[model samples]
Target chain A: MYNILLFAKRELRVFVDTPVGYVVLAVFPATMAALFFLAGSFFAESEATLRNFFTWMPIAMALLVPALTMRMWSEEIREGTEELLLTWPIRLRELVLGKFLGALSLLFLTLLATAMIPMTVAYLGDVDGGVVLAGYCGTFLLGAVCASLGLLLSSLTRNQIVAWLSSAAILIALNLLGLAATARSIPPSLAHALETLDLGLHFYSMSRGVIDAADLLFFLGLTLFFLVCNGLVLERRLRR
Target chain B: MMSPDSSVLAVKVQGLKKSYGSIAALQGVDFEAPVGAVTAFLGPNGAGKTTAIRILTGSLLPDAGSVHLFGADALRSGQDLKKRVGYLPENNPLWPEMTVEETLAFAWSAQGRVGHKMSAVERVVVSVGLEPVFRRRIQECSKGFRQRVGLAQALIHDPELVILDEPTNGLDPLQVIQIRELVRELGRQKTVLLTTHVLPEVEALADRVVLLHEGKKVVEGTLAEVTSVKAGQQQFKVTVNGSEEDLKSMLATAGVTRLESGFPSSSAQASAVVLADGGQEIFEAAVKHDLVLLELAPRSGTLESLFYGLTQAEGLHV
Candidate 1:
């Protein structure tokens, strides 16, 4: 656990030290704001709530989170530093969790910057603080899932572009699972399973102010699943 | 030639074998390095030197072999035995995105040490002379500086065993000397096992030499034992300044067994073989013939020639 924190701090410092890290942080909020205000109709609604703004976050993060996590393992493999990392005394679990939470911490801080949206809406009119808090929770879980999936793909290759493209494809496929399950051509049993696995369904539910235990478990479980896959990939490399 | 039966061995390998796809990287290689000695692993490209080191360092698993480092089974140990062993791989890799200080700190912490990390970082930085570039990003540093940084991180933990694969691969001659000095210093207290193509490096620092060829150990012993007198083959270069007929008659009477040439021109470059303990007879023959010997240098084996001879299968160069 201590090893995880040490590496997490190292990863956070990497974000600060590099100009790209700051660029990612800055551009995410701007793009999220643009998609929130310009792309959607927040002013069109009577209620002064950030529901529309929070609704589009997971879709935007489908692109943004990969950008943040693409270089996590891709760059390490490309630079041959993975060899050193693999041989170090640190456990595979420590290294994976460290980088995962590190990316998540950055995701949290970036979300923190978006607090102005909720604060602005609250100042203008009455807003449900419960829904707003739940929105942040859902977005955080979605980002963790995206980051873990991104890290797993990063472990597949040394090319960040490949990691980015492959992770984006998987995230898009995940968001479409519920729609696929709704198709009349598919069997009901398989459709039900697909609906249960649909990531967007859980993310949207949490964003709409409903933090069901099942919904929370869905996102957290998916994140853990990908992280475990990432760890297995790294462990396999050691045997090679 | 000699294994320390009483003293502890820092590294021991037996029947080590590894294959990549259809290519065999190592084929039943075996060697051991005792404590506090500099052992040079000499071999040509694709000679299993790096593969052997990787297995010893616990970074790669071998197909059929056993490796013991400091009495810990490399194949079975689970508690990060590598923290006690330092390894600088063939192409030393570092985080180019991080500064030199950050890189060293990351390496130090990766070992899971609890004490203040910077003190150990400072110690290695000084030991490797990396203070000047402490704040420079690794991408901004030169190749030599990057190699030094690689060495610093490997040494930061003060490991009991140091494994350097081609430690002086690419560097200026002076930088090579500096690294060699640092490695020799480390050898005084820590067992240093290094692989280098440079024969002078072996001569200057290695107390023992393990030469490999085509993924197998051809020889392992003291430098002198391997490079000195092969067997009963006595070779010498003689330059006699006397008439050919007179030199021949003198040599025949004085027990010089075989001359490369039936008749020798006085003072010409020629090789001669004498009977057992017959070097004295050659000198006596030269004196009896009144030959003014310009050169009488004895031709003995050198590491360079021995390496070439041992690893001459194909594509092997010094």
Candidate 2:
């Protein structure tokens, strides 16, 4: 447990010391705000809620989370520091969890930065705080899922670009699975399975102020699945 | 080689085997490092030196092997045993973006040590001479200082067994000397196992030598034991100003056997190998036969000659 925190602190320090952290911090909120205010329907319906912000959240996270977590394991392998790290007196699971939490923390901060959009919506007119709170909760959970997936892909290769692209591609596929076009082209039963597996669909349910147990379990289960797979990949490398 | 008592051995491996796809990295190799001694691990490229070190340090696992460190089952102990062993792997991998201070802290904390972190960091900092670059980012430091940081992290928790792979690689002569001095100092109290291609460094620092060839233990013994010719016989190269017949007869009278004769030269100064340590008797025989001895020095006993002879033998080339 102590070693886990040590690794977590080291990961956070690396993020803070490098430019990648600031880049994500700036790019994520900027893209989310631009899509919400300009490209989204924030003014078309004249609603006093951050519904458009929540709508654009998953897309923004899909692009930004991969960029945030791509270097977590890939850079270590590229620099040959994995030997040093793995040889330390720490378990593989702790290392995986610590890095996952570190990336999740940064994602949390990125989401926190966009709080001003909701603040602006509240200042302009009446806004339901419960829906806004649920939206933020759902967005953070969605980001955690993305972070774990990005970390798993990062462990598979030493090239950060490959890690980023593979993670982004898979995430974009999962996000698009629930689209009408995708659902219509597939058979009904297959489409239903894909919809249940869609990452964006689960977040969409939570964004509407409905934090159902099924949706919570979906996010948690998927996140754990990716993290376990990440651990197995690392363990296999150690044995090899 | 002295029979290693498992109790006194800092590191012990038996029948260690590891293969990558079709290529075998370590093939049924056994190695031992005694407590409080510097054991130089020498091998040619692809001789499984790094692979063996990785397995000992718990960075990698072997398919069929048992690693015991300080009388404990290292392969099973895992993290608990790792705290007692410090490893500076080949190439000295480190976080280039981290400051020297932060790297030491991370290493110290990774050991799960309980104390004032500053004091622990300062101790290694002083030992490895990392004070000047303590706050400097690793990437900004020179290769020598970067190597020092690598050493510092390995020693941060005062581990009992220190494993260093090519510690002075790519350093200038002065830096090499400094690091060798530090390694020699470490060997006084801790069990030190280091791998190097530099044979002279082994002669200068290693109390024992282990040579590997083709992922197998070629030799393991003290420096004198590894370099010695047989049990009681010694070989010497002698340059004499006399006929080959005269040199043979002279050496024969001194109880020395001529192993090989060099090519006859016009200058009448030919070298021959004599298998005996009768230096005084050979000199007396040469004087009696009126054969002027030019040079008579021990042959085929230096670490360089032994390393080349063992590693470059048939089927040993990488």
Candidate 3:
């Protein structure tokens, strides 16, 4: 755990020292807030509260989270610092977990800043507090899972651009592949399985004020799977 | 130089081998570095110097053989060994974005020793001569300073053994001398294994030299013991202001074989001949020839000759 924390601290410092942190942290919410306010103001007849904010985050994160996490190990490898880090007494899991927690923290802060849209809705009308709270919880958890997946992919290659593009591609396919409502002829079981893989299915369910155990389990499982893979990738390199 | 009665062995390897695909990097390399002395890992480029260092430090596992560091199995107890071992790789990478102070703190923390706060970090920085650049980012520092920071990182935890590979690679002559001094100082009390192509470095710093060739231990011993050939029968080089034939005849009269000559540059005919079995006898012969012996000096006999001699004379264990 101490190893993980130290890794996390180092990761945090990387963010603070580089321009990526400021650009990502500030731009994410700024873009989300602009789109949310603009959509809300333009569509006066819309009945739902803060739907615009929650709706855009999934799409925004598909590209953004990969950009944030793909450099986690790729940079280390390219810089030859992997040799130094692997030589340390810390286990592979500790290093991976540290990076995961650090990247997740930054993503968490970005997501938190978007909460202003929900707050604005509550000020303007009778917003469903329970559903709003659940939506935030779902978004945060799903984002964490996506970040972990991106970090794992990043660990696979030293070229940051390749890591970002591949991670984004996988995320886009998973998040958008099941949303063809027009394909009504598809079998129910297969469609449900496909929807289970979608970020929207689980996220939308939570946003409706329903806290389903399976949905939370899905996000947690995805996060753990990718984190484990990240650990494995590092293990291969450590022993070499 | 491990005592037979002593239970602790600094490093022990048996049949150590590592192959990257078809190219067998290390094959059947075996040796031991005992506790409490500096051992020089000497070899030329592609001699697997860095590979051996990596394997010993637990950064790289071998394809075959076992390594024990300080009585712990290197393969099984890798993390435990790594905790007790500090390594400074050939080209030490510093996070250029970090200040000298920040980098030192991170290195200390990376070793899992978090109790060392700012003051302790400062002490190491000062020891490594990084005080002036404590606040400066590593990218802004010179190459010498970067190396000092690398040394500081390796020494941060005060590990039982310190492994440095080519620590003097890019430094200027002055920096090289300073680093050598520091290494000599560190070696007085710690077990240090440093790799270098510089033969004189081995002569100056290493108590014993381990000559590696093509990933195998070709030679291992104290400087004189490893490099000295025809042991107990000394060697000499002589330059005479006389005809090559005259010098050869003079040494021939004394019964010297394997007579060799250096290129005649300008006014002098310089020749070096070896007496296969004579030491002082050969020296006396050169003096009596009236050959105007311009220079006659004893060959300090270095790991370089041993390395070149071993690689050329016979191929190492494949």
lDDT leader: 2
- Residue-pair clashes per prediction, in order, are 1, 0, 0
Interface RMSD (C-alpha) of each candidate?
A: 1.6, 0.9, 1.6
Q: What value does DockQ give for candidate 3? A: 0.58
Better of 2 and 3 by TM-score: 2
Indicate whether candidate 2 or candidate 3 has the larger lDDT: 2
- Return the TM-score for each candidate structure: 0.86, 0.89, 0.86
Query: Could you tell me which 10 consecutive residues in candidate 1 chain A have the lowest summed lDDT?
Result: A37-46
Looking at model 1, how many pairs of residues clash? 1
Model 1 spans > 4 angstroms off: B1-6, B229-299, B313-318
Q: Which stretches of candidate 3 lie above 4 Å from their native place?
A: A39-42, A46-48, A180-192, B1-8, B230-300, B314-318
Give the alpha carbon lDDT tens digit for every residue of B119-195 in model 3: 77887887778878989999999999999999989988888788999999989999999999888877876888899
lDDT of 3 at A190: 77
DockQ for every model, please: 0.51, 0.73, 0.58
Full ranking by DockQ: 2, 3, 1
The alpha-carbon lDDT assigned to residue A187 of candidate 2 equals 88
As a whole number from 0 to 100, the lDDT of residue B204 in candidate 1 is 90
**lDDT of candidate 2 at residue A180, scale 0 to 100:** 44
**Predicted candidate 2: what Cα RMSD to the true structure?**
5.3
